[model samples]
Target: MQVSPVDDSLEQTELRGPRARTRKLMLDTAIALMQKGQTPSISDVAEAAQVSRATAYRYFPSQAALVHAVVDAGLGPILEWHSDSNDAEVRVQDLLKTSMPRILEFEATFKAALKLSLEQWAERQAGTFGDEPPFKRGHRVEMLQKAIAPLKHTLTEFQFQRLAKSLSLVYGLELLLVLKDMWGLEFEETQDIAAWTAGALVRTAIAEAGV
Candidate 1:
C-alpha cells in the first residue's frame, strides 16, 4: 500500500497519541509474526497486541490493509530513497545496492505479503474475494520510474516505460526470492547479481536508444 503524498500527509495528521500508539503496536506485532513466517490476520495481530478485535478492525479494516501496512513498515528507508546522480545506470545500480540489503532483512515479511497477494488473486479469480480490498503491489513501478528518470529525455515514452518494467524484474522481493531461494546464492551474491542485471538493462536500453 504505497501511499500518495496526499495520503501520507493525511495519515500523519490523523495518527496522534493513542491512535498512533495503537497503530504502531498492531504494525509491530504483525511484523514480528511475519518475521516468524506467519501470515497473521487482523485478528491475530489484535490478539498478539492484546487489543480487542474491534479496535484492530478499526485500525485495519481487512487482512489486505493489515498486510499492506506491514509491507510499508518493512519498506522503511527504501520507500524514501533518492539519488543526486543524473545518470540512469548509476541511479539504478545505487537503488538496487541500497534497497537489496533492506529487502533481505525483511525477506520473510515480504514473502508473507506475497503469499497474501497470491491468495487474494486466487480468491478473486474464484469469485470468493467478497468485499476485501485488493492488496495493491506496485511500489516498484514508481521507484523504478524514479530510478531511470534521467533516461526520459533519451528514450521515447514507450522505451522508458519498457526499461523501467525490465528493471522491475530484477528488483524487490522477487529478485531476492529467486536468486537466493532457487539458486542457493548468498546475500552478497544475490545483491551483486541484481545490481549487475539492473545496470546491464539500463545500459542496454540506452544503447538501443542510440543515446
Candidate 2:
C-alpha cells in the first residue's frame, strides 16, 4: 500500500499529542482554501492540511461541519476584540464594525455558512411559526440586555425597554448580510458604518427615554 505523504506528515504532527494544534491546522487550511475561491471540499482540505481523509473527517464529518468550524474559528479574533474592550459602548462598536471586515476576511466560508443559516432560519420559521432559528433563540434579546447594562442606572423602566429593543434591532445577521453582500463595503468601512449606526442608535434610544 502506498502511504500517502499527507497522512504521514500529519501522523508526525500527531506524535506531539496536542489535539488543538491539529484542529487549528485543519481549520487554517480550510480557510486558506476557501479564500482562494476553492470550495474547501473534504479531500482538498485534507490534502492541504497534510492530514489523512479519515483524520480530517474525524474532526469534521461533513462540508457543513468544516464550514462551520472555519466560521467559528474566524470569529475568535472578533470575540477577543469584544472581550478586550470590556466597555459596553466600545464593545458594541467593535462588534458592529466586525460584521463587515470579519465576514470579508473569511468571505468564502462565511458567505457559504451565512447563506445556509439564512435558508435554515427561513425554513424553521415557515414550518414552525418561528419556534427556532439557527442563531440561538433569544440571542438578540440577550445581547440587547447586555448592551444597555451601563445605561441602566440612568434609565427608567420604559427607557430600559426601549434601549434593549434598539440594541436588538440595530445589530445581528441582517446587518452582516447587507454590509457584506448588498453594499459591497470593505472590512474597515463596514466597521466604521456599523460603529456609527450603533452609536447613533444608542443615542436615539437614550434620548427617547429622556435620559
lDDT (tens digit, per residue) of candidate 1 on 109-159: 999989988998999899898887888898899999999998889999999
Query: What tens-digit string does per-residue lDDT give for candidate 2 at 1-211?
Result: 1224667667787766777688879988988876665656678899998999999888887766787667667655553443354345665665566544565566666556666566667777688534322432234465556655677777787777776776655565555567756888665665677678778877776676675
Q: Which model scores highest in TM-score?
A: 1
The number of clashing residue pairs in each candidate reads 0, 2
Measure candidate 1: CA RMSD. 2.3
Best by lDDT: 1
The lDDT values for all models are 0.90, 0.65
Error of 2 at 38 (Å): 5.4
